[model samples]
Target: MIATTSLQRMIGALAALLAAVGSASAHPHVFAEARLDVVLSADHQSVKALRHLWRFDELFSSTVLMQFDKNSDLKLDDAELKDVADTIFSSLAEYDYFQLVTVDGKDVHMNAPSQVMTNFDNDQLIVLFESEPATPIKLAGTIDFGVYDPTFYTAIDFTEDANMAVEGLPSTCTRKVIRPDPDTAIAQNQKTLTDAFFNDPTGTDMSKIFATKLELTCKP
Candidate 1:
């Protein structure tokens, strides 16, 4: 079940906090706008790292600020921000930092980030982290990458195509952000999706239908 996932436990707390503030949603209680940097090695032969930036929705941001603003000064000081970052870093590690990467139809293993950074911008809480592939991801064929909460407890969306970019992709490569239709995704996964999951996806993966990923095609 999703509740069993360590990441979900923290999400549940955030959901409860949002609910208390009257801002909770149906499935994804938390929402964030995401940007991804697909970094490739100097030779463009393998992926170097993935850098992510997530700016949370206002309601959830405020809820988080309230919790982390230990001094109750309506400001997240550096220390407080680090506290927030630490909390999130610990929680997200078990979920692969909410990142999924594939190369030529094979899964790419990613190591846990060394640390996460937090920033408060325009009344929203922002999180930044970078993950390195455990093994070299050669640019042999199709490479896909996306960030999302599989349990659907958090809605992480790339607001625009421009938000996804390749830092060092060679001119020979082609990449695009493919947005999937939620309805279509749900329909295609009908057999796998149970009614209980729709009612409460605390244990099931809901990412296939919701993840907007960057698909890269390269001939090497």
Candidate 2:
């Protein structure tokens, strides 16, 4: 359950903070758009890797690009790019890279990243990385795959269904989107919380109530 707790903790604090503000439009200080590709191993029996593309908001991108551009070249050369890529990827290691995979309701651990790259487009920071599950499992029955920031510090959004794709999977397998909705009772209660509630950081994971999840189901 450590993994589950990690997933819930990512956004729990952020959700409480947002609820205290009492406005939906006030949230998501950091904005990011992402696309994920699920790569399958040869023979199509297990998940081999995950390829990710994350485009950060302009404000954050500016900060990162400025820091990543070494030698004051105003351009990220090969060495500079790799430096930034490794830095970002390494930093995210503590958060499990916000990627979660489960088979039979159990979490799967991902090994160290094999590839990391970065680019800048229209003043936005774009990152690409690839990783594999520590223990690959057979591809059949039900599989749960989702990407989330657990911490609300950065809001990861997939603007369209097409943003996520599966590669090397049989046509019989299908994927679906699972958008989480806040519990009505919990939503109502948040409105009446006292200042003390916000001060006390201990509480349930309200973020999962609003976090989005991606589910992939396969035919047996």
Task: Give the winner by TM-score.
Answer: 1
Model 2 TM-score (2 dp):
0.73
Give me the displacement of residue 135 in model 2, in angstroms: 1.8
Compared with the true structure, all predictions reach lDDT values of 0.78, 0.67
TM-score of each: 0.85, 0.73
In candidate 1 the C-alpha lDDT for residue 160 amounts to 94
Distance from true position, residue 188, model 2, in Å?
A: 12
lDDT of 1 at 156: 89
Q: Model 2 has how many clashing residue pairs?
A: 3
In model 1, the Cα lDDT at residue 72 comes to 88
| Model 2 Cα lDDT, one tens digit per residue, 55-99 | 888876665556656587777778877776766666677767777
Q: After superposition, how far is residue 121 of candidate 1 from its true place, in Å?
A: 0.7
